[model samples]
Target: MDEQTFWELVDRTGPDPANLERLADELSDHAAADIRDFADHLARALHALDTPAHYHAVATSGASFLGVRCAAVAAGNRAYRKVLGAPAALATYTGSPGDQLLPVAERAYRTSTRADWQHQTAVSTHTGSNVAAWGTSWLHPHMGTTTVEGLAPQDYMIALRHVALTLDADPAWRSWWRQSGLTACELGIVAEGRLDHLRPSADIRRCADRLRANFTCASPHGGADLSARAVSEVRSMFEVIRQAMSMPGLPPTPPVPTLPADVPEVPVTAKPLAAMPAELEPQGYLTLTQIQEFFG
Candidate 1:
């Protein structure tokens, strides 16, 4: 089914309390299992890119793991783009909404913490086809060096070059099976759990089937409707899982931590990394002299 139709159905169904309750009960075990698997796979992907040399490896691995169409890192400044290569002018139409640029990154930098941002976009491509993009953005400080006084800009440039190369060469969709499969598993569990509790008069089965079909159709193109429903369902299931794992008669489970609605830009001031001369090893690290002499 098309995305518009799928979302129309979701809007029509709303969030029926009876359906949610049933879904929670039915999907508890499966949700738990899926979360565990997701965590494990995420951990492994991170481990593989733990080194500075492997930053692009990390991005590629994450994109593959998350089943997104494409993944990129965007720096706080318009001049800086992430994981792709070098600072450049922003794409004319690519500015994020003001509210979308919250202070999440600033807070993380201040605390030297890591944070993730989740976002979705719908845009008409040059070909006039609608393309949807949704994914997470992780912002954290570069752990290598806080001080680059003795370092030349070439050193930094070379480092960025390596990062770009890594991203370019690595697989774009690394963990599709684990992440997407887990999502499907969770959906199934929710559908089954609520099956019995739905009243004889209720069309819960039909609703679930519609959601499933819509979800499958939307996966390929990142349909807005399916994305919204998936986010809602996953969030609801997460809460259920928490409550089920909690002590009996305890207070309600806490909500999942959400990415900031706004990510404020944090200024990064650094001497631009200088480019190494053509004769030297292209990928090798540059020296302080090389940076000074080249740019001087």
Candidate 2:
């Protein structure tokens, strides 16, 4: 359905699940294409609210923030506009009141004998940055586009270690990190590793040593155990960092040499490399130079 009609339906439904069955029935009458259009409009509305200011105003980030935005849209067009005008209005959306909208299209589709829902949008709205001019700004007004390279290795680790410990202590914060798909600590570790790999530095090694020592002392036990969620996230983060490092303007991947055909061929046993320390693992990381160029 068109954006105006879709929102009119939402206002009639009154942001409550009680109106869902009736709403689904109404939507069932429309062409199946409109069902997908409803989803696209909903996605755009939700994405519009995915701003740092909105997140800051609601005192939440990630999926919880998305839920609050959903609640705003479920509040209907006028209420959603109110929120866009004043982000602090989001403070009122404490519950998952808008969750009903999430499944409305699917329910409508299931009840009808029409074709399956097809996405007509150019970009997938499931994830990624909001596609609005007022969306996320790369430059922080107070920080004024500071680059990661500005901080010394030791100074950065001290700050990162503090945050890592904080994340370790609070399950909620860790859960948020899990949703974000990477912890600040994980990024810091990867950044340090990738930079050191490109150019070895004694300072980075010393900082890593100090960080491990501090981590040991922070917990009553030797160190906090990494959760399975964190382990999986870190593994993915590492691959992402490695790929980023191989991007344009950074180092190019070396070509593998071809071996000449010889009279005898031998199968070589590869030597196992020593395991990286949990805190110092160099899997996924960002480069300071890359950040410098980006922020500049």
Top lDDT prediction, candidate number: 2
Q: Pick out the ten consecutive residues of candidate 2 with the lowest summed lDDT.
A: 211-220
Please list all clashing residue pairs in model 2, or write none if there are none: 1-34, 190-285, 238-283, 238-284
Q: What is the C-alpha lDDT profile of model 1 across 144-172, one tens digit per residue?
A: 21121332223232222223223222333
TM-score for candidate 1, residues paired by index:
0.17
Taken over the whole model, the C-alpha lDDT of each candidate is 0.25, 0.46
Model 1: residues >4 Å from true position, as ranges?
1-79, 83-256, 262-296
* Alpha-carbon RMSD of each model: 28.3, 17.3
lDDT of 2 by residue, 121-208 (tens): 5333332245353222221110111112232233222333223332233434434334323323212232222233344211111123
TM-score of each candidate structure, all chains considered together? 0.17, 0.49
At residue 273, candidate 2 shows an lDDT of 23
True-vs-predicted CA distance for residue 10, candidate 2, Å: 0.6
lDDT (Cα) of model 2: 0.46
